[model samples]
Target chain A: MTAAIELNAVEKRFGNVGIIRDLNLSVAQGERHAIIGPNGAGKSTTFNLISGHIRPSSGEVRLNGDVISGLGPFEINRRGLSRSFQVTNVFSRMSVWENVRCAVLWATGHRYAFWKNVDSLPEVRERTSQILDDIHLTHRRDVPAGLLTYAEQRELEIGITIAGGANVVLLDEPTAGMSHAETDRAVALIRRLTEGKTLVIVEHDMSVVFGLADRISVLVYGHIIASGTPEEIRRDPKVKEAYLGEEAH
Target chain B: MNATTTSASNISGKSAGDSLRFYGVWLVGIATLILLPMIFSSGGSLTSFSLIGIAIVFALSYNILLGQTGLLSFGHAVHYGLGGFAACHVMNAVVSHGWPVPLPFIPLFGGLGGLAFAMIIGWVMTKRAGTVFSMISLGIAELVASSSLILRSVFGGESGISTDRTALPKMFGWTFGPQIQVYYLIAFWLVISAIAMYALTRTPLGRISNAVRDNPERVQFIGYDPHVVRYIAFCFAGFFAGVAGGLAAINFEIANAAYLGAIQSGLVLFSTFIGGVAFFFGPILGAILVTYLQLGLTSVTGVWQLYFGIIFIGIVMLSPGGIAGLIMMHRPLARAGTLQTVIPSYVVAAVPTLALACGVILTIESIARTHSGQSSPINLFGVAFTPASPMTWASAAILIVVGFFVARLSWRRVADAWDRAATIARDRGYLA
Candidate 1:
C-alpha cells in the first residue's frame, strides 16, 4: 500500500541557501511520527513541503498515491491534509467558536452557503463544539482567539487543525512553550484527537517524542540522518553522535 | 449523533430568536426611514437625507473590501461612477428612445454595470492584498478617472451626462419626479442592500473573508483560498457600490466626470473609514455624520475640509474604530452601570476641549483673514469681531493658553475615571 505521506528526494531552496535537501520520508497510515531536531533543521520546511504551503525546489510529495507537490495549501488541505503553524495562528478577531466553525464549515462543504445562517448549521456547529471540547477550550468558546492565553491559543490551533477531520494532520511544535504539565496534557490531547489519523509532529522535547512517536526521524542541516522505530533511533550511534549527544535531554 | 442533534435543535431554537431580532432591527430601520421625511419634510433636508441614503450604501460597499476582506481599495469609485453613467444612459434611453423601463429598477442595471467592471479588474486586483493591492487600485482609479475626461461621449466630458428621471415609466402612478419619491426609492434600495450585505457577513464566505483578513495563511490551511475569497468580496463590493451610484444617478438625474474622480473615491474611503470598518453600522454612522458635516459645515465655514481633516485625524488617533468604535467603547461602562460615573468626567473634558477648539478656530480664521487682506469683522459663532482689534487677539491667546492647561487636566481626570470603570467592567465580565 502507498504510504500515507511520502516525500521522495524533496529539495527546498530559498535564494542560494538550501533549506531542505534531498530529503526522503515516508509516514505509514495511522502512524505517529515525530521529527526532532535542533533549531533550523528544516523540519517546519518539510511540513510546508508536504502541506503545499511552499512548492519544493525538486522531487515529489505525495499524500497516499497522488502527488501533492504543486497544489496550493487549500487544495492540499481539501485533499485530506491539514497543518498547524509553529506560531499559534488562530484568527485573533474571531471568537474561538467562530474559528473552529470556519474549519468545520469548509470541511462539511459549506463553501459558499450564503442563504443559510452558518451558525445554525447542525453538522458544522456540532463538530465545532466537539472539537472545542476535545481541546478543552469549550469554556472559552465565546472569547476571541486573540485574547486567549498562549497555551489556550496553541490548543485552539490544534483544535482548528483537527476540526476539519482531515485524515493527515501536520502539527509544528504543538508544545513548544508549554510547562511540563501543559506539555503532558497537550501530548495526551494530541494522541487522543489524532487517534486513527496520521500525525506528523515537529517537536523539540525528546521525552514527549519518545512517549508519543511510533517512529522517529532525526533531521540535521536540511537532511534526515535517521528514520526508525523509537528503540532503533535510540540505539543508533549516528543519531547520538550527530544530535542527541549535543543535548543532554 | 443523537446528542449532537439535540444540541443542534437547541441552537436552532436560539438562532430562531436571533433571526427575529435581526428582522426587528430592519423593521425599526425601515419604520424610521418612513417617519424621517414626515418629521423633516423640507426640500433641502429631504435632499440631504437622500444623499445620506446613497452614502450609506457606498460606505457599506467600501467596508466589505476594506473592513471585511482587509483589501483597501482606492479605485472603488470607478465601479460607482461607471454604474451611475450606465443608469443615466438607461434613463436617457427610457426618455429619448422610449425603452419603457421603470425608474425604480434602474439600480439593478447599475449593479450589473458595476459587477462588469469588477469582473474585468477584480482578478488582477485581488491577486495582491494590503499595500500593493491598495496601490494598484489607486492606479486603476487614476487611470479610469482621467479617461472619463477623454471619453466625453460616455462620461459627457466635464459637465457629465444628464437625463430626466421622470422620463421612466411611472411606478404605482407615481413618477419619481418629486424629491420625496426619489428619497423613498433610495431608502428602499438602502434597506435592501444593507440587509443583503449584513446577511453576507453571516455566510460562510463572509466568515472566511474575515479569516482571510485576520490571518490569510491560516485561512489557506483551513481549506479556503484567500485570493478567491478576496476576489468574490471585491466583486460584491463593486456591485453594491454600483447600486449606490445608480441611486445617485436617479437622485441627481445626471452622471458627471466628477462622479469617477479621485476625490469621489477618496470621499467614500474617508466616510467608510471614519464610520469604523469593524462594525456593520459604522459605515452608516460615518456616511450620515460625514454627509451632515459636509452639508452643514460647508454652509457655515469656508474651511470645512479642514474640519473634516481634523475630525478624521482625531478619529484615527483617539478612536481607531471611528464613531462606531467610540459608541462601542461605552458599552462596557453602560453594562456595568458605571456610565453615570463617567458622564461628569466627560463633561469636565468636553468644556475645556470645546474652549480649545473655539480658540483654535478663532486663531485660524483671524490669521486667514489677515493673510487674505480682508480685515472685515468676522462672525465668531454669532458675535462679530474685528480681526484687527488688539482685544480680539489678546482674548484668543488667553483662551488658547487656558484651554490647553484645563483640557489637559480634565482629560486626565476622564482617563482616570475610564480606567476605573473599565476595571469594574472587566471584573463584572462586561469587557473582553
Candidate 2:
C-alpha cells in the first residue's frame, strides 16, 4: 500500500533561510507521528508543505498515492489533508457553530446549497454538533467563538480543522498554550480524533508525544537527523544527544 | 444541528409558534408590498413609484459593496454616470443612424460599458481592502469626473448629455411619452435587477466575497484568490448600477456630466446609508425616503441642502444599522421575552424624532428666509410669509419644542429596542 503521506528528499527555503532541506519522511497508514526538534526546525513548515499552504522548492509530497505538492490548501483539504494553525485561527466574529458549519460546508458537496436555510442543513448541523461535543464546546456553541477563553478557543480551532473530515491531519502544536488540565484534555481529544487519521504533530510536550506517537522524528536545523519508532528513537544516543541534550525538552 | 437550532443556541426563541409569527411578519411584508400600488390608484402615481423603484435598485446596488462587502467607494457614480452617459450615446447612435436594434436593448449597452470599466478599476482597487481600497475607488472616480470636462466632444462639455427616449420603439401602441409608461418599464427592470442582486448574495461567489471580506488570509488558506472574489463583486455591482443609471437616463430623457459627477456619487452614498446597510432591501427604502426628502424639503424650504446634510449626519451617527437594522432588532427582543416591558420606551422615543424633524424644518426655513435673493415674499399655504417675522419666530419655537419631544420619544424607542434586542439575542444563544 502507498504511504499515507510521502516526502521524498523534500526541500524548502525562504530566500536562503532554509526551513526544510533534503527532508525525507513517510507517515504510514494509521500512524501517530511526531516531529520534535529545537526552534526553527521547520516543524510548522513541514505541516505547511503537506497541507499545500506552501510549495516545496524541490521534492514530491504524495497523499495516499496522489501527488498534491502544489495544490492550494482547500484542494489539498478536499483530498483529505487538513491542518490546524499554530495561532488559534477560529472565526472571531461568527458563532462557534458558524465556524464549524463552514468546515462542513466546503466538504460534503454543499457548495451551492443556498435557499436551504443554513441553520436547517441536517448534515451541517449534525457534523457541527459532533465537533462541538468532541471538543467539549457544546455549552459555548452559541457564543461568538472569539469570546471564548483561550483554551476553549484552541479546542474549537482543532475541532474546525478536523471538521472537514480530512483523513490526514497535520496538527501544529495543538497544546501551544494551556494549563496542565487543559493540555491533558487536548491530548485526549487529539487521541480520540486521530484514531482513524494519519497524524503528524510538532509538539514540545514530550510526555504527550511519547504517550501518543507510534513513531517520532528528530529534526534539527532544517534536517531530519533521526527517524524511527518511539522505542528506537528513545534508545538512539546520537539522536538523544543531538536533540535532547543540545536543546533538551 | 444548528447551534441556533439547538436548545442552547436557539437565539431566535423561534419555536414553532415563533416561526409562525416570523413567517406571518414576512408574509405580511410581502403582501403589503404587492398591495402598495393599489393605494396609488391613479396611473400618475406610478411615476412617483418608479422613481422610488430606481432609487431602491441604485441604493441596493451601492449597499452590496459598501455594507455587505465593507467597501466604501467615493467614485461609485463612475458606473452610474458612465452607464447613463453610455446609454445616451447608444441612444444617439442607434436612433440617428437607425441601427434597428430594439429600445430595451439600450440598457445592455450601458451595462456592458459599466462592466468593462469596473473590470479594469476593480482589478486595481481590489488589490487591497479597507482604507487603501477606498482611496483607489475614490481616485478612479476623481480621475473620470475630471476628464468629463476635458473630453468635451463626447461628455458634452460640462452641459452633460441628453437623449430622446421617444425615438425608440413605436412597434407597439406605446409611444413612451407618459411618465407612467416609463415608470412601469423601470419597475419591471428594478424588480428583476433587485432579485438578481439578492440572488447573487446567495451564490458561491457571494459567500466567498463575504469570507474574503471577513478574513482574506483565511480565504487564501482555503485556496480562493481574494482578488478574484473582489473582481466578481465589482463587476456585478457595476452591472446593476449601470442598469439603474440607464433607467435614470430614460426617465429624464437625458443623461449628463452631473449623473457621474461628485454630487451624484455623494447622493448614492447618503441614500444607501439612509436605507440601512444590513438588509438587501433596506437601501430601497432608504432611496425612497431620501429622494422624497430632497424633493419635498427643497420645495418647502430653500436650503434643502441643510436638511439633507443634517439627516445624513444624524443617520450615520445615530442609526448605523439604518432602518433595517432597527427592524431586525425585534427578533432578539422577542427571544429575550421582554419586548412587552419596552413598550413605554417606544412611545418616549417617537416623541423626540418628531420634535427633531420639526426643528430641522424650521432651522432650514429660517436660513432660507434670510437669504438675500430679494425675491417677492411668497405665499405660505395659508399666510403670506417673509424673512424676519415675529410670527415666523413664534411658529419656529413651537415647532422646535414639538420636535424636541418627538426626538426624545424616538430615541427612547431606539434605545429600548436596542437594549431589549441585545438581551433577547443573548437569551436565545446568539451572544456571549
Candidate 3:
C-alpha cells in the first residue's frame, strides 16, 4: 500500500539560517503518527512544508506517492489533505456555522457557486451541522468564531479541518493551550474524528503523543533522530536523550 | 409544553417579522425614488438627484472592494472612467452609423469596457492584497489619468469626449432627451445594481470574500485560492462601476480626464466609508448625502470641499461604521421601545453643538472673506454684522467657549441616557 505521506530529504531554510534540514519521514495509511520535538526544532515548519504553506528548500513532500512540493496550499488541500493551524485560526467575523459551512462548501464541490444561496444547500448545511455537533459546539454555532473562548475556538478549528473530509490531516498542536481536562477531551475527539484516516500531529505533550499515536518520530534541531512505535521510541537511546528524556515516564 | 410552543412560535415570528421589515424597507426606498422627482420637480434638482442615483451605483461598486473584500483600491475610477469613455464612443458610433441600439443599452457596452480593463489588470493586482495592492492601484490610476491627457484620440484631449443622448435611437419613442428621462434611466440602474450587489452579498463568492478578508490562510485550508475570489470580486466591482460611469456619460453627455482622477476615486471612497462600509446600504446613504452636500453647499459657499473633508473626518473619528452603522446602533433601542427616552437628551446635546458649529463656520467664513479682500459685512444667520467690529469678534469667541462647555455637558447627558437605556435592554435580554 502507498504511504499516506512521505517527506524525503526535505530541507527548509529561512534566509541564511537553516530551519528544517534533510528530514526524511513517512506514515502509512490508517495510522496515527505524532512528531514530538523540542522548541525551535522546526515542528511547525515541517508541517508547513508538507501542507504547502511554504516550499521546501530541497526535497520531495508527497501525498499517496504523488509529489506535491511546488503545489499551492489550496491545491494540496484539494487533493485530500487538510491542516489545522497552531494558533486558533477560525474566521473571526463569520459565525461558527458559516465557518464550517465554508469548508464543507469546498469539500462538497461547491467552490464557486455565486447564484445559489449556500444555506439552501441541504448537503452543505447538514454536513456543517454534523461537524459542529461532533465538536460539541452546536449551541455556539450562531456566535462569531472570534467571540468564542480559546478552547472553543480550537474545537471549532478542529471541526473545520476535518470538515473537508480529507483523508490525511495535519494538526499543529491541536491542544497546545488547553487545560488538562480539555486536553483529554480534545485527544478523545481527535481519535474519534480521525478514525481510519491518517493523522500526523505535531504535539509537545508527551502524554498525548504516547497515549494517542500508533507511532512517533522524535525530531531535534530540524532532523528526526528516531522513528518507531511508542514502545520502541521509549527504548531508543537517541530519542530518550534527544527528546523523550525523563518526560517519557 | 407551553414554553416550547411559545419559543418555537417566537422563532418563526421573528424571522417572519425580519423578512417583512426587509421587504418593507425596499418598498419604501422604491416609493421614495419614484416620488422624489415629483416632489422636487425642477430642472436643477432633477439633475442633482440623477447624479445622486449614479453616485449610489458608483459607491456600491466601490464597497464591493473596500467593504466586501477588504481590498482598499485607490484606482477604482480607472474602470469607471474607462466605462464612461467607452460609452461615449459607443454613443458616438451609434449615432454615426445608426446602429439601432437604444440609449438605455449603452451602459452595457460601458460595463463590457470596464470588464475588459478589469480582466486585464486584475490578474496582477489581485496577486497582492491590502497595502501593496492599494499602492499599485494608486500608481495605475495616475498612469491612466496621465495617459488620458496624451491619448487625445481616445480621451478627446482635455475637453473630454461628448456625445448626444438624443443622437441615439429612441427607446419605445422616448429619445431620453430630457433630464427627467435620464433621471429615470439612472434610477432604473440604481435599483438594479443595488439589488444585484446585495444579492451578491448572499452568494457563496460573497461569503468567501468575507472569509478571505478575515482569514486568507484559513480560506486556503478550505481549498479555495483567495486570489481567485479577489479577482472575481474585483471584476464584478469594476463592471458595476463602469455601468455607473456609463450613466454619468449619459447624464453629462461627456466623459473626461477628471472622471479618472484620484479625486473621483477619493469621493467614492469617502462616500462608501461615510455611509458605513460594514452595511450594504451604507454607501448608498453616503453617496446621496455627499452628493447633496456637494451640490447644495457649493451653491452657498466656496468651502464645500472643506465641508466634505470635515464630514469625512467627523464620521471616521466618531462613527467608523458610517451612517449605516450609526443607524443600526439605535436598532436595539428602537426595538426596546426606549428610543424616546434618549431623544430629549439628543436634542439638548444638539443645541449647544449646533451653536459651536455655527461659531466655527462663522469664524472660518469671515477669515476666508477677509483673506479674499471682501470688506463687506457678513450675514451671520440672517443677522448682518461687520467682520471688522470688535463686538462681533468678542461674541464669536464667547459662543465658541460657552458653546464648547455647554455642548460637553449636554453630550454627557446623552451618553448617560444611552448607557441607562442600554443597561435596561440588556437586563431585559433585548440585547445580545
Candidate 4:
C-alpha cells in the first residue's frame, strides 16, 4: 500500500543555512507516528513542508503518494491533510461553535455558499456540535474562542484541526503548555478522534510519545537517526545520545 | 444514529423560536416604514426621509466590507456613482427608445452596473487585505473621481445628466412625480434591500467572511482562500451600493460628478462607522442620524462639516464600537432590571455634556464668522450676539471651563454606577 505521507529527500534552506537536509520520512496508512527531537531539529519545518505551508528547497513532499509540493495551504487542506499549530491558533473572535463549523463547512462541500443559511443545514450543524462534544467544549459553545482557558484553547485547536475529517493529521506540540491532567485528557481525545486515521505528532513529552505512537522517528540536526517501535527507539544508542539521553536527566 | 435524531429535533425546535423573533423584527420594521409617511407628511420631511432611505442602503453596503469582511474600502462611492450614472442612462434610453421598462426595475440595472465594475476592479484589489488594500481603494477612488470630470459624454461633465422620473412607465397609476410617491418607492426598495442584506449574514459565505476578518491565516487552514472570500464580499458591497445609487438617481433625476467624489465616499464611511460596524442594524441608525445631521446642520450653520469631523473623532476615541455598541453594552443591565441604578448618574452627566457641546459650537461659529469678515449679529439658541464682542468670547470661555470640570466629575459618578449595575447583572447571570 502507498504511504500516507512521503517526504522524499526533502531539503529546506533559509539563505545559506540548511534547516532540513536530505529528510526522507514515510508514514504508513492508519498508523500513529511520533517525531521527537531536540529543539530546532526542524520537526515543525517538516510538518510545514508536508502541509504545503512552505515549499521544500530541493525535494518534493507527497500526501498519499501524490505530490503536493507547490500547492497553496487551502489546496493542500482540501486534499485531506490537516494540521494544528504549536501556538494556539483559532478564529479568536468567533464562538467555539463557529470555529468548529468553519472547519466542517468545507469538508461537507459547502464551498462559497451565500444563499443557504448555515444554521439551517442539518448536517453541518450536527457535525459541528458533535466535534464540540468530542472536545468537551459543547457547554462553552457560545463563548468566543479567545476567551477559552489555555488548555481549552489547545483542545479547541486540536478540535478544529480534526473537524474537517482529514485522513492525515499533523499536530505540533499539542500539549506543550498543558498541565499533566490536561495532557492525559488531550492524549485520550487525540487517540479517540484520530482512530483509523494517519497521525504524525511532534511531541516533547516522553510518556505521551511512548503511550500514543505505534512507531517512532528520532530527528536531530534536520535528519532522522532512528526509526523503530517504541521499545527499539528506547534501546537505540544513537537516539539516546542525541535526544532521549538529555530527557533522562 | 439515535443521538443525531434527538439533536436534530432539538435544533428544529429551537430554530422555530428564532425564526419567529426574526420575522417579528422585520414585520415591525416594515410597519414602521409604512406608517412614517402618515406621521410626517410635510414635503421637506418626505424628501429628507427619502434621502435617509438611500443613505441607509449605501451605509449598510459599506458595512459589508468594513464590518463583516474586515476590508476597509475608500472607493465604495465609485460603485454608487457608476450605478447612478448607469440608471440615469438607462432611464433616458428607455424613454428615447420607447421601451416598456418601468422605474422600479431601474435599480436592478444599476446593481448589475456596479457588480460588473467590481468584478473587474475587485479581481486585483482583493488580493491584499490591510494597508495595501486601503491604499489601492484610495487610488481607485481618485482615479474614478478625476475621470468623471473628463469623461463628459458618460459623466455629463460638471452639469451632470438629468432625467424626468415621470417619463418612466407608470406603475400602479403613480407617476412618482410627487415627493410622497418617491418616498414610498424608496421605502419599498430600502425594505427589500435591508432584508436581502440581513439574510446574507446568515449564509455560509457570510460566516466565512467573518472568519476571514478575525484571522485570515486560520481560514486558509480550514479550506478557504481569504482573497476569494474578500472578493465576493467586495462585489456584494458594490452591488448594494449601486442599488442605493440607482434609487438616488430616481429621486433626484440626476447623476453628477459630486456623486463619485471623495466627500461622498467619506460620508458613507462616516455613517457606517459612527452607527457601529459591530451590529447589523448599526448602519441603519447611522444613516438616519447622519442624514438628518447633514440636512439639519447645513441649514443651521456654515461649518456643518466641522461638526461631522468632531463627531467622528469622538466616536472613534470614546467608543470604538459606535452607537450600536453603546446600546448593547447596557443590555445586561436592562435584562437584570438594574438600568435605573445608572439612570440618575446619566442625567447628571447630561447637563455638563450639553454645555460643553454648546460652548464648542459657539467658539467655532464665532471664529468662522470673524474669518469670513462678517459683522452681522449671530443668532444662536434664540440669542443674538456680535462675534467681535468680548462678552461673547467670555461667555464661550466660561462655558468651556465650567463644563469641562463638571463633566469630568459627573462622568466619574456615571462610571461608578455602571460598575454597580454590571456587578448586579453578573450576579443575576445576565452578564458574562
Candidate 5:
C-alpha cells in the first residue's frame, strides 16, 4: 500500500538560507505519526510544504501516492488533506458552530450554494453538531471562536481540522501553550478524532509524542534523523544526542 | 427519552415562533411601504420616498461587497450606472418597437447587464484581495466614469439617455406617469431586493463569504477558494446594484454620466457605512437618513457635502459599527431592564450635544456663506441671520466653547451609567 503522505527529497529555501533540505518522510495510511524536533527544525515548514501553503523550492509531496506539489492550498484540501495552524487560526468573528460548519460545507458537497439555507441542511447540521460535541464545545456553540478559552480554542482548532472528514490530517503544535491537564484532554481528543485516519503531527511535547504516535520521526535542522516506533526512537542514540537529549533518559 | 422528546418539540416550537416573527417583521415593512405614500401625499415627498428606495437598494448592494465579503470597492457605481444605461436603452427600444414588455421587467434586464460586466471584471479583480482589489476597483471606477463621457452615442454624452416611463406597457392600468405610481413601483422592487439579499445571508455561500472575510487562508484549507467566494459576492452585488440603477433610471427618466461618477459611488459608500455594515438592515437605515439629509441639507446649505464628510468621519471614529451597532449596543441593557439607568444620563448628555451640533452648523454656514460672497441671509432653525453679522459669530463661538466643555462632563456621566447598566445586564445573564 502507498504511503498516505510522502515527501521525497523535498528541499525548501527562503532567500539565501535553506529551511528544509533533501527531506524524505513517509507516513503510512492509518498511522498516527509524530515529527518531534527542537525549535527551527523546519517541522512547520514541512507541514506547509505538504499542505501547499508554501511551495517547496525543489522536489515533490505526494498524498496517497499522487503528486500534490504546486497545487494551491484549497486544491490540496479538496484531495482529502486538511491542516491546522500552530497558532489558533480560525474564523474568529464567526461562532463556534459556524467555524465547524464552514469546514464541513465543501466536504458535504454544498459548494457555493446560495439558494438553500444552511440551517435547513440536515447532514451539515448533524455533522457540525457531532464535531462540536466531540470537541466538547456544544455548550459554547453560540460563542465566537475568538472568545473561547485557550484550551477550548485549541480544541476548536482540532475540531475544524477534522470536521471536513479528511483522510489525512496535519496538526502543527496543537497543544503549544496548553497546561498538563489541558494537554492530556487535547491528546485524548486528537487520538479519538483522528482514529482510523492518517495523522502527521509536529509537536514539541515528549509525552504527547510518545503516548499518541504509532510511529515517531525525529527531525534535526532541516532533515529527519530517525523514524521508528516510539520504543525504537527512544533508544536511537542520534535522536537522544541531537533532540531527545536529557529528556530521553 | 421523555427529556429528548420534550426538547425536540421545544426546538420545533421555537423555530415556528421564529419564522412567525420573521414573516411578521416583513409584513409590517411591506405595510409601511404601502402606507407611506398615503401618509405623505405630496409630490415632493413621494419623489423623496422614491429616491430613498433606490438609495436603499444601492447601499445594500454596496454592503454585500464591503460588509459581507470584506471587499472594499471604490467603483461599485459602475455596475449601477451600466445597469441604468442598459435599462434606459431597453425601455427606449420597447417603446419604439411597440413591444409588449411591461415596465416592471426592465430591472431584471438591468440586473443581467450588471451581471455580465461583473463576471468579466470580477474574474480579474478578485484574483488578489485587500489593497490590490481596492486599487483595481478605484482604477476601474475612473475608467468607467471617463468612458461615460467619451462614449457619447451609448452614454448620450453630456445630456445622457432619457426614456418615457409612461410609454412602457401599462401594469394594472398604471402608466406610472404620476410620482406616486413610480414610488409604489420602487417600493415593490425594494421589498423584493431586500428579501433576496437577506435570504442570501442565510445560504451556504453567504456563510462561507463571512468565513472568507474573517480569514481567507483558513477558508482555503477548508476546501474553498477565497477568490471564488469573493467573485461570487461581487457578481451578486453588481446584479443588485444594477437593479437599483434601473430603478433610478425609471424614476428620473434619464441615465446620465453622473450616474457612473465618483460622487455617486461616494454617496452609496457614505450611506452604507453610516448605516453600519455589520447588520443586514444597516444600509437601509443609512440610505434613508442619507437621502433625507441630501434633500434637506442641499436646500439649507451649500456646504452639505462637507457635513456628510464630517458625519462619516464621526461614525468611523466614534461608532465604527454605525447606527445599527449603536442601537444594538443597548440591546442587553434593554433586555435586562437596566436601560432605565442609562436613560437619565443620556438625557443629560443630549442638551450639550444638541447645542454643540447647532454651534457647528452655525459656524459652518456662516463661513461658507461669507466665503462664497453670497449676500443672502442664512436660515437656520427657521431663524434667518445675516452671514456678515458679528453677533452670529460670537454666539457660534460661545456655543462651541461652552457646549464642548459641558458635553464632555455629561458624556463621562453617561459612560459611568452605561458601565453600571452593562454590569447589571451581565449579572442577569443578558450580556456576554
Candidate 6:
C-alpha cells in the first residue's frame, strides 16, 4: 500500500526564522499519529506543510508516491488529504446539517445541481447523516452552526474536514477548549473517525492525545524530538524534560 | 419551527420543493414575457414597465458581485457599455455593409463582448479584493468613461450611433416596428437573464463565491484559490451586465457615451444599494425604485440630484440591509411569532417617513415649478421665500424631524424584537 503521507527533510522559513526545519515523518496506511508540542513549536506548521497550506523551502510532501509539496491546499485535499483548522472553521450561517450536507454535495459531484434539490440526493444525505451520527452532532443538525457552543463548533469543524470522504485526515487542536466531558466525547469521536484512515493530529492536550493516538511524535522548536508508540513517548526522558522545562518557564 | 423560514417554505417550498417552486417561478416569468407585447401594445403606463425590467436585470448583475460575493466594482459599465456598443456595431455593420447577420445573433456578439471585457478586467481586479479592489475599479471606470469622450472615432462623439431596426429580420416575419414590440424584445431578454442568474446561485461556483466572500482563508484551506473563484464570479456577472446592455441597445436603437459614463455607474450603485444586496431580488427592487425616482423627481423639480444624494445616504444608513433586506427582516420576527405584535408600529413608522418624503418633494417643487412663468420670486402657499423659502423650509424642517423620530422609534422596536427573539432562541434548546 502507498504511504498516505511522507514528509522528507521538510524545512519552512518565515523571513529568517524557521517554522519547521529538517522534519522527516511518514504516516503509513491506517496509522493514527499524534504530534504534541507547546505553543509555537511548529506542531501546526508541520500539519500546514503536510496539508500544503505552506510551501517548504526544501522538502518533499509525497502522497501515494506523488510529490505534493507546493500544491494548493484544495489540490492536496482533492488528492485525498484533508485537515481541520486549529480553531473551528465551518459555514457559520448555515445550520449544522446544511454545513455537513454541503460538504457531502460537493464531494458527490452534486455541486453543479442547479435544477435538483440537494436534500433529495439519497447517497449524499445518507453519507452526511452517517457522519453526523458519528460526530454526535445529529441532535443539533438543524441548528445554525453560529449558535453552537464553543465545544460543539469545534466538533462541527472537524466533522466538515472529515466529511469529504478522504482516506487521510489531519485534525489540529481538536479538543483545545473542550471541557472534561466534551474532551471525552471528542476523543471517542476521533478514535471512531481514525479507525480506517491515516490520521495525524497536532494536539496540546496530552491525555486526549494518549487516548486516541496509537503512535506519538514529540516536536520541539520545529524539530521532531522523538517518534514512537504512546508508552515510549511517555517514557522518553527528553520528552519529559521538554514538557517539564516549558512548564518551569 | 422557525416562523419566517417556515413561511418562506410555503412560498419557496422545502429543500426539494424549492426546485419545483423555482421551476414555477421561471414558467410564470416566461409566460409573462410571452404575454408582455399583447398587454403593452395598447398602453401608456404599461409601455414603460419593461424599462423597469431591464434595469432590474442590470441592477441584479451589479449585486451578484457587490452584494453576494462582496466585491465592489465601479467599472461595471465596461461590460454594460461593451454589450451595447457591440450590439450597435453588429447592427450598423449589418446595415452599412449588408452582412447577412441576423438580429438575434447580434446579442451573441454582445455576450462575447461582455466575456472579453470580463476576462481582461477580471484578471486584474480579482487579484485584490475590498478597498484596493474598489479603488482600482473606480480608476478603471473613470478611465473608460473619459476614453468614451476622447475616442470619439469609434464611440461616435456626443451624437452617438443609431440604427433603425425597421429592415432588421422579423420575428416570424412580423416586423418589430412599434416601440412596444421593442419593449417585449427587452422584456424577453430580461426574463431569460434573471432566470439564468437566479439558477446560477444554485451552482457550486456561485455557492463557492459566497464561501470566498465570507472567508477567503477558509476557502483556500478547503483547497481552491480565492482569486480563481472571484475571477469566475466576476466574469459571469460581467457577462450578464453585458446582456442587459444589449437589451438596452435594442430598446433605444442607440448606443452612446452616456451609457458608459460615471453617472451610469453611480445609478447602478444607487439601484443595487437601495434594493438591498442580501437577496437575489434586492437589486431588482432597488433598480425599479431608483428608476421611478429618476422619472418622478426629474419631472417634479430641478433639484432632483440633491434628493437622490439624501436618499442614497438614507439607504446607506437606515436601509443598510437594503429594501430586500428590509423585506427579509420579517424572517426572525415571523419565526419568533412576534410579527403580528410588531406589525402596527411598522405602518406607523412608514407614515411619518412617507409624509417627510412628500414634504421634501413638495418644498422643492414649490420653488422649482413655474405655474404660468413667474419672474424672479417664488412663493409657497401665501408666504414668499425664494426657492429657499422660510415657510417651505419650516415645513421641510418639521418633516425631517418627524420623519427622523418616527424612523428612530420604529427602528428601536425592530432591534428590541430581534434581541427578544435571540433571547428566546438561547433559552430554548436551539441555541447551543
Clashes of each: 0, 28, 0, 0, 0, 3
Off by over 4 Å in 5: A246-249, B1-15
Where does model 4 exceed 4 Å of error?
A: B1-19, B376-380
**Candidate models: Cα lDDT each:** 0.88, 0.75, 0.88, 0.90, 0.90, 0.75
- Candidate 5's C-alpha lDDT? 0.90
Q: Write the per-residue lDDT of candidate 6 for residues B114-201, one digit (tens) a residue.
A: 7788899788888978998899888888887778777877778787778766666655664667766666667767777887787676
Docking class of 3: acceptable
Tell me how far the alpha carbon of residue A43 in candidate 3 is from the true structure, in angstroms, after superposition.
0.7
What is the DockQ for all candidates, taken in turn? 0.53, 0.21, 0.46, 0.55, 0.55, 0.34
Error of 4 at B255 (Å): 0.9
Please write out the lDDT profile of model 5 over residues A9-91, one tens digit for every residue.
99999997899989999999999999988898899999999999999999999999999999999999999999999999998
Per-prediction share of native contacts kept: 0.63, 0.11, 0.59, 0.64, 0.71, 0.23
Candidate 6 chain B: 10-residue stretch with minimal lDDT? B3-12
Which digits, one per residue and each the tens of the lDDT, describe model 2 over residues B1-432? 111211123432258987687568656655555566778757646666777777777787787787656688887889987888888899888888887765666777777777778987788888888899888888888889889889988788767788888887653676668766676667667767776777676554555556655566665544456676777788877877888888888888787778787898888898888777766667877899987787666666666787788877887787777766666555555656666667667676666666565555554565666775544454445555454567766766776787776676677566766676666667787444
For model 2, how big is the iRMS in angstroms? 5.5
**Per-prediction TM-score of chain B?**
0.94, 0.83, 0.95, 0.95, 0.95, 0.84
The sequence of per-residue lDDT tens digits that candidate 4 reaches over residues B1-432 is 011110011232366777788789989999998999999999899999999999999999998999889999898999999999999999999999989999888988888878888999998999999999999999999999999999999999999999988998999998989999898888999999998888788788988998898889888898999999999999999999999999999999999988888999999999999998878888999999999999999987788999999999999999888888788788779989999999999999999988888778778988998998876677777888788589888878888999999999999999999999999999998776
Regarding TM-score, does 3 or 6 come out ahead?
3
- Comparing 2 and 5 on lDDT, the stronger one: 5
lDDT of 1 by residue, A1-249 (tens): 789999999998899999999999999999999998878888888998999889999999999989999999999999999999999898888878878888898889998666787767888878988998999998887777777999999999999999999999999999999999999999999999999999999999889999999999999999999999999999999999988998865
> What's the C-alpha lDDT at position B329 in model 1?
78
Which 10 residues in a row give candidate 5 chain A its minimum summed lDDT? A240-249
Give residue A71's lDDT in candidate 2 (0 to 100).
Answer: 82
